[model samples]
Target: MVITVVYGVLAVICLGYFAGIVIYTQTVGFALFWLLTGLLLCAAGAYCAYRRKHPDRLEMPLMLKSAVFTCVSVGFLILAAAGITIFMDTEEEAPEDLDYLIVLGSKTVGREPSDTLKLRLDAALEYLQENKKTRVILSGGKGSGEDWTEAQVMYLYLKNAGVQTHRMVMETQSTDTEENVIYSLNLVKKTDTVGIVTNDFHLCRAQALARKQGKTEVYGIPAKSNWFLLPNQTVRECFALLIEKFMGNI
Candidate 1:
């Protein structure tokens, strides 16, 4: 009876979790994975409830139970580790004197910048307004769905926002973070100090990648992450960080 009640409660929680992730996030991989796992939990709960009513039925095999427990424990550990990385922050507060600022790109819809990209640009704009001597590098290639290259869009947006054309350098050939750093570095002198401007959730890995590329004197300039998309983005970044770790990119 106790096991049945516990499973029933878990089923409710799992279903609720699925609804929240699917409806709120609308993110592809994360939402779908959560929803499917939730449905499986719901089914398992239903089976448990049925078995409680018929105690003669066999329980879940011990090996399967152990596997489930192990998977859950490992998942929790990974999540906890990723959560700790959020606070392993670098020098996020914009400095008054930077020789170069590399503003990383986000997705662009048609010709308009995504909200994520806009926030990074807004941060750069503020820094540029205060530090006129700092040259800017807008880094991103044209993604498949984008109408314009992210770098071009950022360059044009900042130009209209009062940053001088000569102060901006567009790096449109690189498609990923490694290339973003590598190509942007090529445009500047090795002796030059750089400020990495990216979303707050991305700062830890971005700085790690910079250091991997031998950029020793880099400062992180974090932009505000979108509140609605924060959960999805942070979860996705955790997976990305894992890949970067395995690839030895960070």
Candidate 2:
């Protein structure tokens, strides 16, 4: 009965989180994770309720139970370790006087920067102001429904904010983070001290990708993320890290 109640409460919490995300952002993204987890929790809750009524009936064999337990334990450990890797670099900052700074792009609101992209641009702007010699590569391609490529939007924002055109270059062909690093690196040497500017939760994976691409002096210039969205973004990043590892990109 207690176990059933626990699962029931957890299901409601997860489902509530899913609903809140849907209402707030309108984009599913990683919030689908909450939806699926909520449904699974609901099913688990139902099973717990059924088990409570059945008592001794439908008992599992000890060997199979042990196998399931082991798998679950191992999976939990892997996820925990991945989460730690992401969190540890959330507050990372790049050293000054980098040879190049790659500003990874996020979504755009028409021709303007979205909040996520704005944060990244703002962080990069601050760094550029301090490190005048650090050239920037604004990296992102156009996506569906976007009025302009993300790199173009970033370029406009930074240019209007007083960053000189000569100090920035646009890599408007690369669509994702891996490509962001790849195509941007083509504009400069791999031996250059490059700093990747992105949201705080994304720095770890971004830096890993840079290293995987043979960049020996890569650094992270983390931007702040919305506190309310951090949990969802962090989980999505954890899965992304795993995927990148599986694909041998990091």
lDDT of 1 by residue, 53-88 (tens): 887786878899999999999987996698679647
lDDT of 2 by residue, 10-83 (tens): 98988898888778766777898988988988988887788788978777789998998899799879888999
Error of 1 at 25 (Å): 8.4
lDDT winner: 2
- Per-candidate TM-score against the hidden true structure: 0.86, 0.92
